[model samples]
Target chain A: MRELTYREALREAMAEEMERDERVFLMGEEVGHYNGAYKVSEGLLDRFGERRVVDTPIAETGFAGVGIGAAMVGLRPIIEFMTWNFSLCAYDQLVNNAAKLRYMSGGQITLPIVFRGPGGAAHQLAAQHSQAVESLYAYVPGLKVIAPSTPADAKGLLKTAIRDENPVIFIEGEVLYGHKGPVQDEEYQIPLGRGEVKRTGQDVTIVAWSKMVHAALDAATELAKEGIELEVIDPRTLRPLDDRMIFDSVKKTNRCIIVEEGWPFAGLGAEIAYRIMKEGFDYLDAPVVRVTGEDVPMPYAKNLEHEVFPGVEKVVRAVRDVLYS
Target chain B: MDKTLMLSLYRDMIRIRRFEEEAARSYSRGKIGGFLHLYNGQEAVAVGAMSAVEPTDYIVATYRDHGHYLARVGDMNAAMAELFGKADGCAKGRGGSMHYFDVAKRFMGGHAIVGGHVPIAAGIAFASKYRGEPDVTLCFFGEGTANMGAFHEGLSLAALWKLPVIFICENNLYSMGTPLYRTLSVEDVAVRAKGYPMAQEIVNGDDVLEVREVIRHAAKRARTESLPILIEAKTYRFRGHSMSDPAKYRTKEEVKEWMERDPIRLLAERIYALGIANEEQLKAVDEAAKQEVAGAVRFADESPSPDTATLFDDIYYEPEHHEQDEKVVPLEKRRQQASV
Candidate 1:
């Protein structure tokens, strides 16, 4: 095992995948000469040359659509958005074409493409730049939305996404890129749509994904101080939601609290809460509570930003509220 | 044009013309619903251009796609069924007139967004070139789509990458009451191709022979050079934009002037003058085309609607990897491995 940052792991995954498969390639605005805007593809362009590691013009819709078409014709393309915020320009290609082609064509075509980049609120990037889209993409049927919080999960999940037959929106938190974790050296792939329990306990189950998983762990530590032992669950893939795992865990713990970085209204937390009621309501000792980002455009000010986003305090409060109720 | 070919072209043009007319009538009678953009005078463009290309080649068109649909892949019945929202339609009735798609015949789709299909066609052409396939994609769009950013981007990218694509812009003068004069400074739509350094050809779209000859050359050049070509087919729409339009833009005299150049009649006159067939034989060909269309209508009407249970069926690939993963450790055991 080797300790690598999430950014390095992602770059390593892209390089390894490209070396292994001739059909696999990476394309984006700064992916080639600049070595990726966030350095996620630091040494890839020099290693693989320009055709495989293309530096496209500022045409997200054009390149994204090109990748989809390439994927349909047997090339497995990995398209990187500078950030998930810029994906709005390619919404039609992602939503209408990439997501619907297989079904619209009656399963005649398979789009083996991966649209990857940093997602969710980062630093002081306000409003248009700092919105979390986990719930937004998860709502689509034909896409597999995966958000990886750790370096190992980032590498393994990205490899799996590149090899996936369908188009996958691989969301990596921008702040988590510098976070290092133990990753295996050899070929390893974490299966999509599977949930992993970060820390197990018997009192309450906290379901989360991506960066919120880190917050859940922080919340779990604080909640344990008050004698509330919580089990944190990271649903690696959002679309093929691993509800069965959550349901089973909730049934055992008799309590559930969901933490999410997206907006509260119609957020992924809401879906999890609904599922918990539908499947594990009778076993619950308390009603499911949710800690989510405030339903407003993310503000630029630090204090207001902290208030809008879900943090350890909010998760702890929600967990305490659920346990006490 | 040869006597035999002219007669055949005339027959195809008339089939598309009469078929769209029937569709407009049916739509007015509530047999069809949704946005139905009739391509009455535009029949010659679709028939002429489609005839110029090979069967294995691809076609991508705009929302007003019935003429292109009947001319390329499906019969009049499947087209009508699609309009009527029947399961036997090309998209299994999920997509109405605007969203016609036939994968078997390499007819990609009728995308509703103005310039949406442009990049898709370019992508298809790129795929063909990358795969070393000698196939060209013919992307059909109205003059209105030229104003979109996608059109400029797609055309530029196609030319830059040297993709084998022929953009057939059917300039019927009006983009739903907004004429070409109002939308663009340059009257000729072919001038847009100059920005991309692509070869452009302007054809009298109402004359099937002119369109056919131009498309033939354009398709050939696209196939050989792996480059983009543009064809501006200056045609006219005989009907309203859709069923709801009053067609208040132009006078009847203008319509009459364009009708004088009706491609089907022109081709028929030329075929008869060239002694292709007697009047009786020509009538038989016309009757056969109509009968074929009538048979398709019967077939679609008799076909059953798609079952409701199937709505959730094709939404996603049903995780074939699940079965493979099941052979591994269960969730309980996997968690236990975490301890190691």
Candidate 2:
């Protein structure tokens, strides 16, 4: 295994997919010439050429729709949103067009396009710049939502997303791009909707995804010092959730603490909590606790920003509460 | 133009008018529900522009899309049945009046959200360009939709990528109850094309010949040069925005003024003036259009309602390729484990 940064893994996935399929192409603002806003698509323009690695104007809805239309006509377009927060400008195209086209057209059209970009609170990027919109897209029936927490998962999940026939909302961790992780030299794909139990334990089940998965793992390590073993699970795909994994983990641990960077109300964790309660009601020793970002919009102040989103401290507290309640 | 072409345009415009009239009647009788935006005075914009494009070209229309659908040779019975909420409708009754779709004809859809379909139209054009196909997409929207962010986004992308798309803005002067002038800063929608740096033209929407000539050139340019164009067809609606509209926004004099330039009447007059058809032949065309509409109504009345058993079908295309991994337990297995 060779170590690669999350950014490099993403570029490799895209470049490999483009070489394999002529229909596959990348288009977004600053994707070409400028390399990429985040340099995730670096050197792709020169390799794939300007036509395949297109640089689009700062029109999210326009290019998003263009990707959808191209997918309808048999082109697999990878549309990048500089960040998921900017995706709100193209929300209509994502929810109204890309999400509903298949159902509205009676399945005559398949929008095999990936709307991917960095998401969630990163550093001190204020309210507009920091938003975790996975719950919003996952709510739609026609969309497949995936969040990759590591370089290997990023590469594998992205490849699967580009090949999938349904519209995929690939939300990447803005903070994890620089994190180095082991990535296979050969090509491989991680199936969507399969949860991976990163660490096996017995006292409590800690569920998270994307950047929060690392936080949960850290929380488990901290709780381990106190002689409490926490099983950490990363649900790579959110929409077609791996209920069996979550339920089985909860059934064994009999207590669960869910963590995410999205807002508390109606968030992905909320749905997971509901599903766990509905199915594992009798197995629970205590109520399932949720550690989530504050309901208010993200603030700019460093201290307040850190307080707004969940971290290892919040996850640890939630686990303690669930275990001791 | 050839006599046959002139007569055919006249016939298509008449067919749209009569079809809309029948739709209005059906709405009045409570046979059609939801919003029914009739395309009465704007028939020439659809008929004329659609006639210029090849059969393979795509069409993306707004809620008021009956004319666009019929102009692209969409099935009359299916269109009427869709309005009637029958299973035989174009969208299988799932999409009422505002969401007619026919994949076989390459008529993309009838999007109800104002200005929402503009980007999708650009996407269709991008797809065609990506495949090296000569297909051009005609996207129709109202003057009101011109002020939307999507209109700007869509047009900018179309021009930036030089995608083969013709943005046809049917400036009927009113967006629902609000006048176009109130919403848009510019009097002519074509002026906005300067922002996108795309070629644009304003055409007499009531004159079929002028619209056809302009759209023909625009479509040809899109295919040969990969250039997108904006055509603001100055037109008006004869009736209210929808079945529920009281139309108190404008005066009767204003409606009457536009009615004087009615597209169907203008085409009929042109047919007669060019000696393409006599009064008897024009009368025969009108009669035949009325009969065709009557037959559509009959077919809709005979069609059955959609089967409730398959309500969830077509929500997603589940091919064999999407088979679940063996490692991932199914929902039923999870439920069984929970019971234990």
Candidate 3:
């Protein structure tokens, strides 16, 4: 096993995929000459050259549609949004063309493209810059949404997303880029729509994804000291969710708590809570509680920003409430 | 011009005119649904531009794209079937009149979104250049689309990358109801090309020959030099924007004025002046077009609706693989097994 930061793992996944397939190219604002806005694509331009590692203008709608068009003609394009927030500019291309082309074309066309970027609250980037849009993308029927929470998962899931013969929305946590963890040295791939249990317990289940996976893990550790065992599940892929794994965990633990960085209204956790109530209600000892970000524009101040979104304390409290009930 | 070429162009334009008339009738009769933007007056632009490109070249158009699809695919039956939402339609009825796609003919699609398809056209052109293919992509949109951010972005990328794409702006005097002058700051849509440093031209969209000549030049530049060109075709839609629009925004005199310079009548006059054919021959061509359109309607009426079971199909590729749940032990169970 080799240790790599989340940033390095993403770079490796892209670099390896580009080498494996000539059609695979990376295009985005500041992705080439600037290495990357967050340097997640560092050294790719030098290795893959300007052809594959393309630096585009600050036109998300333009470049995102360009990627879709390229994919329409048998090319695999990896479009990087500077951040998920900027992806709003290209929402039509992502939601309309890329998603509907296959279905509209009656299977005559396939859009093998990936729209990936840092998402959710990052420091005090404020309202416009900080948004968790995975739920918005997951609502579309033709899209495949993946939110990887760790370095290994990032590498594995990204590779899988690029190879998948459809439009995929790959959401990377803005804060998790620096987190280092063990990744396999050999070539590997993690299947999309699979949930992985980071820590297993019996009293309660904590289901989280992306950056919230770390929060759930921390809460699990803190709860262990208090003799409250908790099972932590990371749903790597959001759209084709591993529903069985989540239901099984909730049934076994007899209680469930969902944590997310998005707002509570119609958020990922809201959907999960609905599913748990619908399918796993018979085995549940208590109601499924959701720990989500406050329903306000993220604040610029550090303290307010921290309070806006979910964290370790929030996850722990939600788990405690479910366990106690 | 050669008599055969002149007659061919006339036939194409007349075919479009008849097809649009039929589509309008269908809409009026409650056979068609959704927003139907008819290309009644803008036939010359689609016919002329499509004539310049090869069969292998790609084409993308806006919601009012029946003419473009007919020009590219030359399949009147399929086009009508698509409007009828029949399974045998170009898009298998999944895409209504607004989205007519024929991958075999290289007609990308007719996107209903105002300016959304511009970048897609550029990207298709980018793929052509990347793959060393000689194919060029032609993107057609209304003047209203020029005001969208996608227009700027798509043009900038196409110009910057020197992608092989020809952008045609059919300035049909109005975008739905907003007049071009009211919406766009510039008089000539081609003037916006300066921002991208791309070559551009303004052509009389009523003159099919002039439109064809300009598109031919643009297509040549795109293929040989890998340069993108924008051409603004001054045209107008004879009917209201859609079936629902009464078009009271413009005066009856304005409609009459545009009708006087109708694209089909202009081409018919040109054919007569060139001694290609007389009024009788032109009348025969018009008659043929009517028959062709009638046949198309019959085909559409006979075609079956798409199977209900296929409603969920084509949404994703190999969805079965994604549906399967993987077997895995819980973290504690794995740890316990490792300890044993």
Q: Can you give the TM-score per candidate against the true fold?
A: 0.92, 0.95, 0.96
**Could you tell me which residue pairs clash in candidate 2?**
A66-B123, A69-B123
Better of 2 and 3 by TM-score: 3
| Residue-by-residue lDDT tens digits, candidate 2, B210-245 | 999999999999999999999999999988988889
Best by TM-score: 3
Residue-by-residue lDDT tens digits, candidate 3, A1-325: 9999999999999999999999999999999999999999999999989988899988999999999999999999999999999999999999999999988877788889999999998888889999999999998989999999999999999999999998999999999999999999999999988989999998888899999999888888998998998899998999888888999998898999998889889887888888889888799888899999999998899989878878898887887787674
Please state the CAPRI-style docking class of candidate 3. Answer: medium
The better candidate by lDDT, 1 or 2, is 2
lDDT of each: 0.84, 0.89, 0.91
| Candidate 1 residue-wise lDDT, A1-325, digit = tens | 8999999999888988999998898988899999889999998988999768888788877778778767766788899999999998888888888888776655556788999999999988999999788888888878989999899999999999988888999999999999999999888999888989999989989998888999999888887787878998898888778888999899899999998888888888888888789878799989899888888998899999989989998888887787784
TM-score ranking, best first: 3, 2, 1
How does chain A of candidate 1 score by TM-score against the true chain A? 0.98
Q: Positional deviation of B132 in candidate 1, in angstroms? A: 2.7
True contacts kept of 3: 0.75
Error of 1 at A180 (Å): 1.4
The segments of candidate 2 whose C-alpha lies over 4 angstroms from its true place after superposition are B321-340
* CAPRI grade of model 2: medium
Clashes of each: 0, 2, 0
Worst 10 residues of 2 chain A by lDDT: A102-111
The better candidate by DockQ, 2 or 3, is 2
